[model samples]
Target: MLRGRARREQAAHAGGTPPADDPLDAAQERRVRAVLALGGVPQADLPDGVQQVRLRLLERAAKGEEAPRDVSAWSAVVASRLALDWHRAKRRQERLGERLAALRQPEHQPSGEDNRLLSLAVARGLDGLPDNQRQVLVLRFYADLPVRSIAEELGVPEGTVKSRLHTAVRALRARLHEDEVV
Candidate 1:
């Protein structure tokens, strides 16, 4: 059995320190909300927007983007950018869908016949990439951060970031072509 309150997370909004089941600190949530609001995201959509930021960061981390040292600040950056991306995606719904769908199939293959092959091929290629190259690609594409932002977050020069991205893309392209997915 477990013992001690140290193992449990403390809830901040509560009147006193109590164990909180929510993984995100109440303070961090506030930062995320503030960022979303500042980005012109609706107050009504704040929760969903914050959730989007959380999920995106987690997804990027899983895909190989390094977790930030300052999670609260990182979440703010992510929330603001995600809000922008959400608006952009909403503005281009039809065009984005067709383009995204096109990635899974060739000109004649049906869209639903398993677009996963290409995704799997890409995953395999990512696995083969060097750590630095892989991290840059995940940070740029999955986290949707710009080169400068990625450089700041990763503590590297922007030129280094570009080089890693270039190498990563070349490797993935070669892998995909070899696999005949491209």
Candidate 2:
């Protein structure tokens, strides 16, 4: 129908997917949008709700079912249903995000004694590393020096600094595993 085509063109111009050859006429589309907006659907999602209603109407036609006796009323109901579904989905996402945030929080806060013991173990581990390895490790970790800066400060190539850092961390990890300090 000319009216359907015109509505599709208008939808296209408004940055929505044009419901090409849709069953809903212009007035019907307007009613669908109004119903969706009034049902608490956000403005940005109104076009999508309208498209859903149009798709359902076309789907009925595609299935060889008789068109609804009252197209406007049917579209309005469909739009309202879509709006409710959207709200339900939004609430579900908010609940899921809250659950994830709760999971990320620490269940038991570390005690001061635990932190002190860990710090002592780490200091002892550092003391056991070779001089060059220990120097680079301290500069990189404690002093928060980058690889390039470490190389420049120590007058060593960047690759050499990286190799030392890797070997040192491996050795320290092995030592910690052997001591059961971690």
**Could you say which candidate leads in lDDT?**
2
Q: Per-residue alpha-carbon lDDT of model 2 for 83-182, expressed as tens digits? A: 8988887886676677656644667866778667767888888999999999999888656567998999999999999999999999999987777877
| lDDT of candidate 1 at residue 158, scale 0 to 100 | 100
Predicted candidate 1, C-alpha RMSD = 9.4
Give the number of the best model, judged by TM-score: 2
What residue pairs clash in candidate 1, if any at all? Answer: none
TM-score for each predicted model, relative to the true structure? 0.49, 0.51
Give the runs in model 2 whose Cα sits over 4 Å from its true position.
1-20, 108-182
Model 2 local distance difference test score: 0.85
**Model-by-model lDDT, in order?**
0.78, 0.85
TM-score of 2: 0.51
Q: After superposition, how far is residue 36 of candidate 1 from its true place, in Å?
A: 9.0
